[model samples]
Target chain A: MQAGGLPDTNQVSTDPLRNEVPVTALGEASVETPTRAQALLRKIEPYLYLLPALLLVGGLLLYSVAHTLAISFTDWDLITPPRFVGLQNYIDAVRDPTFTRSFTNTLVWTGGSLLLPVGGGLLLAVVLERIPGQRVLKTLIYLPAILSTTVVAAIWSYVYTNNGVLNETLRWAGLDALARPWLVFAPTNTLAMIVASSWRALGPSMVLFLVGLQTIPPELIEAAKIDGAGERILFWRIKLPLLRPITAVVVIMSVIGSFMTFDLVWVMTQGGPGRSSETLAVTMYRQAFIMWRMGYAGAVAVILSAIVIVFSISYLRATLKRSAL
Target chain B: MKRYSNAFWPLLVALLLVPALLMGGSIAAQDDPVVIDWANDAAWHEAGQDAVGEASLGVTGIGVNTVIFTSTDTYQAAVRGALPTDDAFPLFDWWFGYRMKDLVDAGLLADVTDIWQGHIDKGEYPASMMGSFGFDGRAYGLPKMINYWVVFYNKHVFAENGLEVPTTWDELMAVAEALKSNGVTPFGLDVVGCRWCSFIWFEEMMVRVDPALYQSVMSGETAYNDPQVVAIMEQWRDLLDAGYFSQPGDFSDNWEAPFVNGDFGMYLIGDWWTGSLERAGFVAGEDYGVFVMPGITEAGNRSLIIEGRPLLIAANSPQLDVALEFADYFMSVEAQTVWAETSDINSPNLLAPEETRPGHLVDLANAVANGEYELYTRYWEATPPQIVEQVVDLLGQFVLDPAALQTVLDGAEQIAQDYWASAGGE
Candidate 1:
């Protein structure tokens, strides 16, 4: 009957005298009993219900992804006969300077995004949980999460433009000399895009952490306080450790999202100012769609998937180890 | 697993039923019409759609369904993705050469050569525009519209700044310097979002310097980083450094914005840009005038980069005969006239009557007829796709750092050499 526990059987029974109802009638109830063949049919009925959906989704995933992998090994251009090229696509990708740049950009993007959003979200969640009007603050902070990424990118593109709102505001506040083409400049473009990415990413992490924060019992914190813990000590020693699992989830999600950062770059820069802003995903898209080199693109995609899988596995393993400790 | 069974069944059943219902609904919806899917570029303004709607009223025997995509990049991607499937649009506008070759080689494009030959024998469209649709002496598409780059300058801006249309390199430099000194940006070049814009400048310069050299580079006859190319890069860099461009880093800014605002003097863009400019509330011949790009060589010849949008029929389309008939009708003078008047696009059919021409289109026709133009296919359409990307990216980088001219040129040369070797080029 408690919120966290399973439902009580006592609540289902109206009276103790109802237990005298015939056992044979209960067995014969349409919801309960069947013959041997019917029981076997009943046992497999759920599987029958699920068969079409399983086949549809499973067949699609297998055909598309497996077909893509097979195409990656050939010299298919989405048009011509797919000549078997072995590992040429993979080899070419490694040798490509643009591909190398894209790879490095994705790494920086993934690492930087994970740190900012997950860390900031945790910090904000801990602080905001105790603040007055926490619900209002939570709603305000989480609003951007519900907006489409296209809308977010459009707003951020204007802010990042040369004479845009960001620069205009900076200039008015006596930062005139610091203003430059934010998204056009080489080393700064990636950083600028990452900032925009973090803004959109912050909301989801904050919400996740808020939910995680609520699950940590008030009694634990009270006990920590009674044990003579200061605010800083309580946070670092108690709250932080308790929020570790959620933080791991947030970080892994952020990493994957950052690695696949395409829309923001596509809408804003289109991988421009000379390929400085291209991620591996953008490169894959260009090779696949723009150039119609499907095989090469497939190779890039396979490599990207491998990287994501590795990162996710290592993250899970580390999270598990930390939780065990 | 048994403990979770209660939670799992309802969720599973709901998920399973939703798709089944949707599939049934779609199947039921398809029984009423002969759907012909026609895909068009985003650049085709609403007027084109209106014209199509009007035109389709005349063909009541056929039921047509048009899916218009606004983004050229997305449209191309969709067409490529849909090729292996039965669901690709029955007809679509595709760029010539590379796009046509790829589609034809894949056996995805219907051979519309017979239709084209029939049109040609009837003297419907120009033979030159047929160059775009033809690959290895076979036609796969019908050229719907033709476009070529011309130097479009603001006459008011030029007159106010006491500058004439430059016909030579020296005059262009002088005009640019004068404009810069007077606090006006000389040109509006959108080099930020598209590397293709920068390539236009590169090719324009290359053609002016030596058309043969440009063709050699495009056809892999010469290295992309050759001395001639380096010179062209140096010239481009010099122009940028001299303040010929309005805003170098503002690549996201539409070229027409600065031009329309009367802050920039000129825009080197294709004829198709006139539609966008008109949409932005600018008039041609009154506010702006078209001129030939200046000559870098002694010949004083003008070469315009031609890009054609060809309407192609899908090979596997069940309605192939209907599609060809529609295509033949689409390329006729009557249809082209409708296209030119309504969409404000230049028709490849030379017979498009002058009476039906839009204001700027009339001017374009005049310019082409006066022997002031020669059609040169866009480098993107002419060159290998990888080479196009490499060249464009290098040009964009050069715009940022003029000092990186040699390095960019060298990089392009390396890519060109590699491409040539791989492609078995002579």
Candidate 2:
């Protein structure tokens, strides 16, 4: 039977009961109307429970990604009606000086962010595992992680100021000529901000490394030690291989975080002294929000997302392949 | 498992309705008490809020909900993203000038012409000032006050060095020379952390070369490499070359001691900077004084760049009526009085008593109406924001390396072509 342009979903099959299996003593029909409804419900119950969550998650995530992609091809200034301009925004970004500079700075930021945090954290974790005062030293290193980004930015700004402690120490050590303004120029300013970002990020990276290292069986290390494996030998041969999974996670996170740098750069420099220290994220922000060029900003964001996805997918595939072997 | 799964669907449906009910209630609530949302950038946040609070007190039972963002960029982002939607504030603090035209063109701003016209008919607001906020006979904003860029000089430094406030370009240069030779920095331009702060000198020089030419450049009609613009940059470079400005800038905090202690003799900036001096315990007239910055050639028009925070009404706001009411109140002399008292600045409303003004602002206003001074909006706001972002960066580059003036101008000219061409197409 039809119901509002669709079939009645609860309709029962028009089959004779003669072919149904018979119960001798109870004499109750096995395929009754109530059981048919119950069977349908049983079949769809799991999906019914999952539908709400799936709709919410898939709806937001897919909608946002789709919208960003669509907006990348349009000329929208947030206030104005969006006009589809195809690949013009991306083509413009390719030649735009600020975009190019930000793209290059993003690469540098990512490279520095990856190496400093991941490497330093790994090395520190290794050293701490063998050291006597592990707990106290761990707390000291982890303390910075708990401090807010604003607090970190303020602390570093003071440390990097021309008359800050760094310069004062340089003067006291008869190196007054060597002291200079850290956040006042290009490349140097970018490097200074990167140092501050890494300082704030290193604590978490070390903690992740420590957690990963703790999961490794001490018995295996002892066994290696008994087999004449020295300190360096053990780290390279066993601990390093064992820590690969966590390292993969750490590297991806650090690289992504670096590409997404805004708060540190904003608080420290605000992408200034001539837009020299701007990263991809900061450029996107300036374009979309400050400049009121939302479409071009979307293009920048899409490029940033593509770059991030490329690195992440490449790393993930390599890790998965290694695991497969 | 059945019991837990059975409860989930109803819960999910209920959750969706909660937001719907709340959203529905919000739209309805806008009709009563005329509760309007106001988003303010930090510069105007404190004074604007105080003025509204005090003014709303005068009008019985009006709720002005304000959210203040410390960073200008953050608040600008909010307006760009949240405007033309129910979520956006009915009223927001904005900059006066070309920004309004763009917002109006995009249909994001309400044409508050009636409110402005009502004030005009009553002889409360000036007709000359209203022209900047108007486009195609429809006005988009209210001219709140004027903050003319002026020379703020330390009185004691001037007295010690036998210097008086210069009346012309030549005299100003001679004063700079005298002060610099005496080991005192002529200008208190410590803007290391904020490279954009250096653009005021560019702003000053642009208006100085020729106010009309500056306006043309701001409107994207003239290129940055225009002979007049080049001359302006060259003059700015000359000032930088003379070592007139103090070294190693203080990053824009008023608490910096150099300007107050008389190490720096003068600062060529907006008159509002006197408030910063006041906050730092410097008396307005005795410790520091202000003067109209002279152009190379006046031609009987001493043009001054006026910069200030503007209050704007969102067209799509649920509380549009009340926002307009607040705008009407905000432009009144009563509100302007409270604003100046709380903000310590000048009000554009003619009805505002002169005694309610800052000492230097009052002097500047007298010069504006009766003397040769012509008040114009700051070029930074006068130009398109997108273009301003690009050209200002070049201006900063010119400051970093004065020799790169030619390069900076060339780059700026290219950026001008791109944005202006796009704007024309639109």
Candidate 3:
């Protein structure tokens, strides 16, 4: 290894665990073997630097996850000592109609997020790329994304309420039939929340797409134009194909975001008109906190996490393997 | 580099040591006036603190620091998550009856039986009040406030419509019809303001239908979808069909605003909301008057729904002696009077002077006494919280679309059945 403590690639590949004698970067100092204590110190130094983060992960994140997992197998009201109920809670969760509704709503949210934010963002980015004063326009569009989730939820709740701006506008436009209590019912409530979510999400998705778009070589677009290709053809052929990598990242993020949707739905609909608009995240919180069924809620959280993890892992693995090739 | 490293150690050590020293200093000074942590979610927490200050004069060396939580859900989550631990507040507000059962069973609540015995012996509180806070033959909490559910009407609106407070089911329907025809939403069924608001009408309707059946259904002796319950839902639906309720979307976090603005002519809620109405600039006798909603049947007419909230002591309180002193002092007439007058709510301590109570409460108390009404627990605390939450959600849907009565009832029944089956019934 180099004396500056930058290990050589060959040295690392050959004997990763072995202590190496280092020559100075200028190759002036003689190589000296590390003593046993020095070798142990070298091994322990990296972990020592990592100790705070390790403690944090183990103490907070991993401990809570492990505790939740343990509680999932029991029947615990907040007040009572947990009674082990085996897989009853899981069975109950699966058989429960509310869980089924929440699961279905989560899927709808995921699909809506992909289409609304990702698809709409790409269109927006492409359009902004051609427009003058794009920077200011982009900032304005992204403003909602910078607001807190609670604020966004509050704003949307006002717009979507029964006698709210949307309904009033509809009535003014002589389109009373089109107006309804946007956050008070089933499909519409979920759809309204998705639109609100999409509005907040569009900014980041657009920025990411813009970054992707700019990375494409100018020569490529010039060549496409020289080949008698129009704007639509260029976007469909070269631009869309090259944008796949960023799209995959955005898609994964949107899917995960949709799965963990609690704040907006909670603040707006509260997963209600009777849990009709609940996502898995809202259901988990309501069960644990509002209903005080810790064990049942644990089962729900585990199910939600398992779904997200499995989807993320499989998608990421596929994307990484393809990207590597 | 060596000089920097030499200085960094002491700097980091100093940073860590300062906080440790401060914490130790605070711990050592615990012998000073003890500040017991009191957690609550009510808007009247300042009034509660005032009452605490008054009570502290009697229970020497102990003052309370009241912590406010913004919502019921957040408050319950915070309190329940910290229970059976020293980290929990030594004093916290909680609902009475079934809501207190789980906490009591877990032994997370201090046994306040002795405190109750003292209050009862002094005739400060009635023995009947103890039943709601008792489990396993021991009282676990002291009454914080008692509120009766009654309809509060705008006296001007009633007079303007040439109507009087309805005394029969038919009269109530006619009043509703008259109000609706006059283009005023006759009722405040603002299910959107809070999830629990959905249960207010469900509870009102249940007892109005039959008090015995209300008890049977709440205790899980009868199915939630039973025909009688369905009949109650049908009656509620008829009200909806008549367009007596303002749309749920018409409500917001400022739940009292629309009622205060005269958008709705009447609101049926706990008498505790009297303070909120007053805060909204409604005079007690001039702007509003309270009346029991006439029942649909003879049994329903005889019953009144009441909500009792309690102040619980943590069993693991570090200052158990101070907590006990606070609890005992809070039950005294002096404390109750200060609490009632300041908070504008009724005190369960019967010995509290009637003049100290709010005029609305006094009038309602007189009417209830004269009518010989049988008081029952409010629906929110009458059943297990799990069932209440699930059923309330279903009821919220029913409010949105009254045509889905059968579907809502079925869903409620399923939830109640699952809970009862698992709990092995009450």
**Can you tell me which runs of candidate 2 are displaced by over 4 Å?**
A1-56, B1-31, B43-71, B81-89, B112-123, B136-138, B154-171, B178-184, B190-192, B248-263, B274-283, B299-301, B316-326, B342-345
lDDT tens digits, residue span B167-196, model 1? 787898888888889888888776666656
- Tens-place lDDT digits, model 1, residues A1-325: 3474733333222222232343334444432433343456557868877988899988998778898899899887655568899999999999998899999999889877877788878878888988899889888888888878778877887787677788889999999998888877666888888888788778789989998988889999999999999999988898888988887888888888888889888877778778888999999988887777889999999999899999899989988898998
Evaluate residue A213 in candidate 1 and report its C-alpha lDDT on the 0 to 100 scale.
Answer: 85
Error of 3 at B8 (Å): 3.9
| DockQ per candidate | 0.32, 0.32, 0.35
**Which tens-of-lDDT digit does each residue in B98-136 have in candidate 3?**
888888877888999999999889977667667778766
The per-candidate count of clashes, in order, stands at 2, 1, 0
Q: List the residue pairs that clash in candidate 1.
A: A79-B106, B192-B251
Give TM-scores of chain A for all candidates: 0.86, 0.87, 0.87
Q: In model 3 chain B, which range of ten residues has the least summed lDDT?
A: B1-10
What digit string (tens of lDDT, one per residue) describes model 2 on residues A1-325? 3554532222232222222333222234643664565667767777877987888888998888889999999988777779999999999899887888998888889889888888999989988887999999988988888888878887887787766777889999999997877876778888888888888788889999999999999999999999999988998999988888999999999999998998888777778778988889988988877777788989999999998999999998998788677
Listing every candidate in turn, what is its Cα RMSD in Å to the true structure after a full C-alpha superposition? 6.5, 5.9, 5.5
Chain B TM-score for the candidates in order: 0.87, 0.88, 0.93
Best by lDDT: 3
Q: Evaluated with DockQ, which candidate comes out highest? A: 3
Rank candidates by lDDT, best first.
Answer: 3, 2, 1
